[model samples]
Target chain A: QQQVKQSPQSLIVQKGGISIINCAYENTAFDYFPWYQQFPGKGPALLIAIRPDVSEKKEGRFTISFNKSAKQFSLHIMDSQPGDSATYFCAASKFNTGKLIFGQGTTLQVKP
Target chain B: EPEVTQTPSHQVTQMGQEVILRCVPISNHLYFYWYRQILGQKVEFLVSFYNNEISEKSEIFDDQFSVERPDGSNFTLKIRSTKLEDSAMYFCASIGASTDTQYFGPGTRLTVL
Candidate 1:
């Protein structure tokens, strides 16, 4: 049972374009949604996170748009750069659980 | 900037041997966790440790696997008998009590033959 599902296993975008990755979850108990970026041979780094109370959060060029009613969230990267080419993973976890349920990763490629 | 640190970025061991992976989480963090990622697979949670004990563990964490916080700074995962299926990249993460964001270590790639 994959609690969180992500679409478009791979993505390609031109430089300065908007790169978008979408994720959905079935568990209503999930309150914390986060996006992680991982480069090859390294660990996943926290990119952006949003709580259920907020409809959207923007950090630098990264934005997370969350829709609680639809049980969906999406990550948008504005001005996508070639350096941003890597794997992105969306994760969800409930309070006090300390266990993150991750979605299938999306590999993004930005062509300069 | 505080970050999680792991030892032996890569380890190669034979089947039926014992291997212990070590991690040093951030100094101020209290919650610790272990996760594994197989080649081209999503990260899977193995166990979570809090208050000096395991709070939760996944079904994949069997009796052959064990986690211990031997000291104030070191968290270790020991696999009693390594199997070929245990080959994967193991990551350690830590979070503070006030935040839900987890900081991850650089991961250790374990290869079992």
Candidate 2:
């Protein structure tokens, strides 16, 4: 129940296109959700995040759409660029405990 | 732009040897954590520390593993005896007083042979 399952093991999007990745979790206790972007040989970096209380959160080109009832969330990247190509991870955690359960990760490739 | 930092970008140790991975979280961050990721695998939560104490740990954080905050600025994870299976990328993360964001270090790649 602690697993955060992510979809599209790999994704290829054209430049100026939209790229999306989905994730689901069975742990209802998870109140915090975050997305991370990792370059090769580098640790994951915080990209965007959303709480269960909000349906969606957007920051520049990255947005997180969350559905509390479905226990699902997704990350959407607008105007996909080659620089955005990397492994993206979705994670869930409880606010108080702060232990993150990460998804398998999605390798996104934006073609130029 | 305070970010977490880790030492020895890569560590190579033989089996049964002891090794310690070190990290320095953001200065003002109050929560610290350690997570591991095998090649092409998901990030596995190892442990979380808050207020200088372990708040929680996963099954993967076995008896062989120990965490310490010996000083105000550093946090460390020690393996009493390393094994071949311990080879992976170890990451240290930290979050400030707010609970939503966690900043991760560059990671220490542990290669046990």
Candidate 3:
């Protein structure tokens, strides 16, 4: 079973537009949710993260909207730029176990 | 910001040969982890290490897989008798403390032919 599932295997957006990616999870025990950005031939870099307690968290152009009851979360990029184009992955993890369950990645391409 | 470092960005080996992937996590980080991603698939966890010992591992971390922290800064994953299916990108990560954030390094891509 894919504990974490992401939608829109690929996304295309225009520069200065909004880019959104959604994810769902089945495990209620997951307390930590994080997003990662990866480029070709590189490891994923942490972008933004949130806990279930918070409804939303924003960092500059990146934002995370979380729904504890719905068991879903999403990442939104405001005023999306060409520099922001990359593969995005949503991941969930519980404490101590150190194992992170990742969703099928969404490749976001921004056209200028 | 100090980041984790990995060696040999890519490697190719014949099937049934042993291969070792190396990583150097950020200093002061207390926990270490290993993850792998096959091309066109999601990233999967392999194992976690803490206090110089393994804390947990996944079923995919079978007998052919082993991890070790042989020195103060080096963490290694050894795969014995690698199969073509073993070809993938291996990532190494570390968290500063139990409750803190985890950081990742550029992964090593291993190709078993």
The model with the greatest DockQ is: 2
DockQ of each: 0.87, 0.88, 0.77
Cα lDDT tens digits, model 2, B37-96, are: 999999999999998889999999999999999999999999999999999999999989
Model 3 DockQ (Cα-based): 0.77
Q: Which stretches of candidate 2 lie over 4 Å from their true place?
A: none
Pairs in clash, predicted candidate 2: none
Residue-by-residue lDDT tens digits, candidate 1, A1-112: 4389997899999999999999999989888999999999999999999999999999999999999999999999999999999999999998778699998899999999
Total backbone collisions for each predicted model: 0, 0, 0
Question: Candidate 3: misplaced stretches above 4 Å?
Answer: none
TM-score of each: 0.98, 0.98, 0.97
Positional deviation of A89 in candidate 3, in angstroms? 0.4
Candidate 3 accuracy as lDDT: 0.92
lDDT of 3 at B56: 90
| Stretches of model 1 off by over 4 angstroms after superposition | none
Q: Report each candidate's C-alpha RMSD, comma-separated, in the order given.
A: 0.9, 0.9, 1.1
Q: Tell how far residue B27 is off in model 2, in angstroms.
A: 0.8
B14-64 in candidate 1: lDDT tens per residue?
A: 999999999999998999999999989999999999999999999999999
